[model samples]
Target: MEEFNGNDQAFTRDSLYGTASEPTYAGVTSFMRRRYSRDLQGVDLVVSGVPFDTATTNRPGTRFGPRAIRTASVTSAWERHYPWEFDPFDHLAVIDYGDCNFDHALPHKIPAAIEAHAEHIVQAGCAMLTLGGDHFISYPLLKAHARKYGALS
Candidate 1:
């Protein structure tokens, strides 16, 4: 397990390289207790939420999925990620970049919004792990990633 000084390591820490000190039930809720930031300067990977559920075919409650996932991850983040026995934070620089922004009234522009949001992150030389919105959101995300890394093989 990684070590931290106190609560709220998310704000005080300068890099995404260390584990958070916040306890499972307290402090800010970021994915794996990573810092919440938009700065991608030296970040290796970004975890962001896509709270859109408009494209879902069935239940439309995925908009809240990201937050719930982040909250639940607190317990797991305190230790190495399962059987892997290795702390990813020790190698990868990651941060929770918050959620993608879009205007709910403009349904047709949603895909574009998602693509643009992801594109910005990819363009900054950082990989992304999106939380949730709907299965359809992956299509736009793929497009953005492909544009950055080239055709997936």
Candidate 2:
């Protein structure tokens, strides 16, 4: 197992229930170096990105948040995370679903796009870990989540 986990498990591993010990600077930069899969068969969680920031009243650079976050996640991809007794990947089948696809030209429709993206995962019985874009991304995310699991704070 050590021989396999020692390399790029992001696209090489056959399973989604273990850790990836690839060099922090190399390999597919998926969230936590997890496999970049759209298959939700038995997945417990889906990490996706929403690169939309046009709605922000402040700076409009948040469109790149998702990519930035994915890059940063690499620094902590190996072994057990600090302060935690166990690695979540060891128990949960997590995958990087990549970024939400939407027409940035149609800002009005981005919210619905985000909502639907989340709904697909939730409906599949998998949890979501959305990244990037702006806080407004929450508006659509919460709506999708509420539909699946009921009221949320």
Candidate 3:
């Protein structure tokens, strides 16, 4: 495979497609080294994080999982996803939309925040693959996705 030269493709690339050229150990980390943007203009997918672990009981480290996942993703961005003959990025425009913002001090508002965050992506004509924060997040995520696309059934 030929080497790519676009360092920090996550933030530098102009197109919605094509692979990043950055070295695995360098540059800012984004999902699959995709662009870091909320613009969603031609974006086909948004990888956003909830990062809310307040609902967890036994473990509370989920808030850090999104970043860890993004970091780990660096190693695999250089090639097509395993077991597949094609590169997903060659056809899809994906981005790391960053984390959902909410006032953690106010637990009651978290669900709405999550829903609104998801709503923005859906409204932008992009599908989302959210990193887990806590199981409770699913409740809001489901509601958000359903509201945009219809009933889960």
Candidate 4:
């Protein structure tokens, strides 16, 4: 575990696919293994990759959006500026929980897997920030969250 700056926190890497000799960009293993400046217990946000883009309109590679976002977020070195003058990474606890596993053989399995995973996260008392395979992924995420926390009614 590595700490950025003088922060006394370490990020843990968790993979659903198990470990491999090399990292995988298309799966959850790569996303979870990135270093960050916070601990899971102290995390205010858990960003995850939900790479399932069966409904892509143009390019099909949008399914990889989650992995791309995770890479961008971790590699970013932007400092905060404004009323608050601290690094956002230093203050907010965020982790990449990696991608939700979906069955490519069965299209319906995508939504089911997403909902199940999101429910578990919500039940754990953490807010889920997810990457999309497509915009349609939002529907299951919201549905699961709403079921647990109730809708905006």
Top model number, lDDT: 2
> Which pairs in model 3 have colliding backbones?
10-35
Worst 10 residues of 3 by lDDT: 1-10
- The runs of at least 3 residues in candidate 4 whose Cα sits more than 4 Å from the true structure, single-residue gaps closed, are 1-42, 78-84
**What is the TM-score ranking, best to worst?**
3, 2, 1, 4
lDDT of 3 by residue, 1-153 (tens): 224656787777777687756789988888888778878888888999888899999889999988999999898888777799888888887888999999989999999999999998897789999987888899998898898889996
What candidate 1 gets wrong by more than 4 Å, as runs, is: 1-3
Which digits, one per residue and each the tens of the lDDT, describe model 4 over residues 1-153? Answer: 222232111233332112122223232232433433223565566777787877886778888787676555433322343566554444455566666788878997778888988887777777877877788888889888998889745
lDDT of 2 by residue, 8-101 (tens): 6667877888775689877778888888899999999999999988878869999999899988998887778789888788889889999999
Clashing residue pairs for model 1: none
Reference-based lDDT, residue 26, model 1: 75
* C-alpha lDDT (0 to 100) for residue 35 of candidate 4: 37
TM-scores, all candidates, are: 0.91, 0.92, 0.93, 0.68
Q: Indicate the residue-level lDDT of 24 in model 4.
A: 31
For model 1, the local distance difference test gives 0.85
Task: List the RMSD of every prediction in angstroms.
Answer: 1.6, 1.7, 1.7, 7.5
True-vs-predicted CA distance for residue 114, candidate 4, Å = 0.4
* Model 2 ranges off by over 4 Å: 1-7
Error at 73, model 2, angstroms: 0.9
Determine the C-alpha RMSD for candidate 4 after optimal superposition of all C-alphas.
7.5
lDDT of each: 0.85, 0.86, 0.85, 0.59
